[model samples]
Target: FRFFRWVWRVTYLTTFGVLGFTAYSIWEARNPADQLEVDQSKKTLVILGTGWGSVSLLKNLDTENYNVIVISPRNYFLFTPLLPSCTTGTIEHRSIMEPIRNILRHKKRAVRFYEAEATKIDYEKKIIYAKDDSDVKGDTMETEVPFDMLVVGVGAENATFGIPGVREHACFLKEVGDAQKIRKQIMDCVETATFKDQSQDEIKRLLHMVVVGGGPTGVEFAGELQDFFQEDLLKWVPQIKDDFHVTLVEALPNVLPMFSKQLIDYTESSFKEEHIEIRTKTMVKNVTDKFIEAEISKPDGTKAIEKIPYGLLVWATGNALRPVVKDLMSQISAQKNARRGLEVNEYLVVNGTENIWAVGDCAVANYAPTAQVAAQEGAFLARLFNTMAKTDAIETEMRELSAKQSSAKAEERTAILNEITERQKQLRRVKQIGPFQYSHQGSLAYIGAEKAVADVSWFSGNIASGGTMTYLFWKSAYLSMCFSTRNRVLVAFDWLKAKFFGRDVSRE
Candidate 1:
């Protein structure tokens, strides 16, 4: 009886402690005293985009050092790794998004945010011209904001490679809106296929889901679609269970060319088990409302054009430069030769220009355009800017000390001279920051049937893993990497909810 009484008391204390902490956090978030007003004396630092790169930089930046202003059409940072899950209702779209305001509130100073699209960047004048593209707008919808330093992280757009009918008929998996559209269309296709008196050929055509590109995005989406079919659609719409099919087409010889050979073999075998057809060495030449014309290469060095009828088509070929990036490149003489993205030096400074830096997909740093690469680039920029701020302070102090030495008395003059020497040494140390170096963490992808694959750096070498254990690792890794506590908690809840209740099939 005494032990039970002690246990109850401990539990009560713990519960109260947690409640108190939560209350304090909410209060602090609501009323942050560190949000300082903009200081005109400080240099203005303007950042673009709210993607992985920009968000990582914002999270680590010393806002007190600069009058920071962030401009992005999106007001939230999205966790891109689990984006595919959003398409099949395994995860909600909101679960993966963290509001930009929520992130800015923790800063030492308040940063200005504008919901607008940057139309042009006047590099010579250091001015950004942006237009308010949102529904709600003020009297002045367009404005120009000048900055002493600029960061371009606008990312990339989907690449159709000039394929006709692709932009009109295919669904993309890049944004939250795209995921929602795909979800609605999936159910729409299924329901339309089930209409009374539908012919067998039409039903087969409506149930066929074709995914272009064998990259991680396409593979993951295909996997999620298969899971949705097996877990929910099969049980709910039993009549079309056998008719459902998913096909992934790639121009390359094999899928997951970036992954290890072992993992690729495993993924192919796993896809086979899941009844997902993978067509390699096949190029999609044309896409129509109901069919895609593809040239399939034969082993005998022959090519045959085949028309594949599909209800839902997802195009994930790769990324292409945004128009804004291309326009900026055209304005700079040095960037004229650059093909893929903005050419940046080791410090990520845009070539042929000072005070401008690029990160993520917009910057060509000889690294694959992955979320991890962008995130590390953002962190590097944060450190670089912090060091630069410190160097500036030290130089200013050195100049002040030198002036004091000339005006002070004999003893005071000696002290001022000594201070000048110390300041100079500090300035030198702060300016010695080396170039940006990316440390490759690893690559991860999830296939169907509760399986995953990973090729991670282990110590000096590399370690490749796959199957159910890797799936658990993948889950834990992504959960830990979520942007905030709110996101992590929400994702955990969604996963649990999906496991227990199955995916929500109510399409809206």
Candidate 2:
């Protein structure tokens, strides 16, 4: 009987030994800790744009986890929120732009940057064809890059529609080049009109400025132009001071459709006070070198056609899909319905492809193409990638232990298996950003000087604030949103200087 009991004990020990060994082996086979090791295998993340969205991603991403590359024609990210101020020299253009290279210096790993425009994206083979301005003029210096992940943050282009002569004569305020052109044109017209030989009608035409589309951009530009005339032109160039005029034309009945009714009234009242003409319900039908033809909706519901001669016409219309994004959509069958931009799923992944992801204005994220949206989306993606890396590590460790179970002791084997299971739960715990939900922080528009409007959240509900206190809040909020502390301090100083003296009149 004693001999039988000894045999049973041996059998029981051996069976459990095999069970533990089997568990370890199976875990190791599946886990492949090395294979699962966060794909640190030189996976390339291609970011396209130096705008707020792409820049925000670059700032937040885990650089050590991937080979990061940024592609954009511009080498710096322009702070566009304060761009209107640049037109009047309230802030130097250079002050609002931070170099892309300087921004990337904060990355854990050096990022590859391309100062070229992406011409085509071959998703079938995962390649991006690009060309620089020098190479775009039928040159043979085009380049191609292969990427594991491609982020399309190319933003949008200015919409000219199909209005005749509009593209040729109207000035757009979408880019830095546009602003510079407008400034130079403004000066050129003023100088030429003030010529001793210029006629009265010609001088009036040269000084007359018409701004189309009363959106935030148009309103802001008009305000800046008025401020320029009131402060600088009136004092510096008094020859054509009486002849100068500024007109804002909007198709909508209200100046600011996005603002509250009270704010809109305030803006209109302010414009009226400044003698700046506000033409609402006015649709520009055609634009000529010296005049603009528009159909005005009258109180009697009749459309009256009128022509207004002007020296400068600024078009601040909204954006349209860029050519690159349009081409990409045509090339991919799954993206056929994506007319606005590349359609993305909840994961920010391209609808058809699993490996590819897109962010920012180029992607149809079901959210407003605002800087705030893109920045948050990019940060979310970075956090997701980081979690993926951790999961891979856990899985790899489990697989490795399973494969070497025969060599590990029973206690060590059991402990390793428990750890792997626990890691799996942690991986599951990582939050995934489903279809994005935008939280409205608030909307603020700078009119001029210390006048602004803001619709912000209050303790009870949303509050519409305007005037001096609102202007102070607007400045503080934008300052805090600046990319760095240095930027915040510089912007603050610029405002102080502008208040104490006046805006600089020098144009670079």
Candidate 3:
């Protein structure tokens, strides 16, 4: 009886605590502290893209130090690691998205956001030409934003490698729209296969799903797709189950080249158990509406061409430079040899440019184009910019003090000199910031069936682990990394909702 009483009291207390915290969060979000209006007198810092790097910089930057302007097509910051799950309804797309307005509202100074795509950057004039690509726009839709400083964080686009019919037929999984298209297409294929008196061959073709690339995006999407069928689709549409199949094609010998060999082997084995066919040493040459032409390498050093039919083809191979980045590169002779991305110095400044910096996949800094690397680069820039602002302020004060010393009395001049010396010391300390250094924390990928693989950097060594536990860790890590507390709560609720009710199969 005493134990039951204790349990009852503890449960109510915990419930009330949760309620109180929730109320406080809601109140705080609704009523943000007033921010200082934008001052045109300050340096104009223009940032492109709403990806990992740009968002990270916005979060850490001292906005009051400069007149900040963010230009991107997207008005929300998306947590992209769980993008794959969106295709199968494991998590809603909006759950991982945080509004740009919400982010800027909490800043010390007002930051402006323009939902426009940066068409080109004029290096000589320090101007960015942008076009409002939204559906609703006024007469004056295009404009130029001039900046004293610029940060190029416009991320890369999907790479087709010049494959024929790829852009027309194959779907690229990179954005929210891409995921929605894939989701709707999956249901469309299932329904089409169930059409009355459908031919066996056509039914098989309609039920087939094909994914290209062996990278994390490809692997994770494939896993989510397979799980979608096994857990939900099979129950409602059992007749099409026997014909349902998934295939992953990769030019390389193995999937997930970035992961450890053991983890790779384990993942391959897991996929085999799930009945997902992996076609390695296969290069896709052409993608048609109903089939793909692939060159298969034989064991005896021979190549054979074969046509593989697919209902849905998802391309997740890799990234390529955007047109804006390409245009900017063409303007600079130093970037001529930069094939992958804009060549950047250790401080992430663009080569041959004094006031321009680059970050994320748009910049080649001898690092992989991943979110982890981009976030670290953005934080480093925030520190660098903050210090530069302080240094400038101190230098201005020193100049004024030196000019006053020429006319001031002897005692007053001595006092001014002492203050000037102290200011100089402070300036030196602020400018002592080192170059950007990226510390690899780790990598994680979910491999379906409640199993995941991770290569984490422990204290003094690396710990590579996989299986169900790692999947939980993957969820927790991503949830914690969400852009806002609201986003974290939404994502957590999404996971719970999916687990209990199964993923939604509705096409939206």
Model 2 over residues 96-133: C-alpha lDDT tens digits?
A: 77889777765667788878899998888899998876
lDDT tens digits by residue: candidate 3, 324-417? 9999999999999999999999999999999999999999999999999999999999999999999999999999999999999998988999
lDDT score at residue 318, model 3, on the 0-100 scale = 96
Model 2 worst lDDT window (10 residues) = 31-40
Pick out the ten consecutive residues of candidate 1 with the lowest summed lDDT.
25-34
> Which of the two, 1 or 2, has more TM-score?
1
How many clashes in each structure?
Answer: 0, 7, 0
Candidate 2 ranges beyond 4 A from true positions? 1-40, 134-140, 406-411, 431-435, 506-508
Selected candidate, larger TM-score, 2 vs 3: 3
lDDT scores in order:
0.94, 0.81, 0.94
Distance from true position, residue 33, model 1, in Å? 3.7
RMSD of every prediction? 2.9, 16.1, 2.2
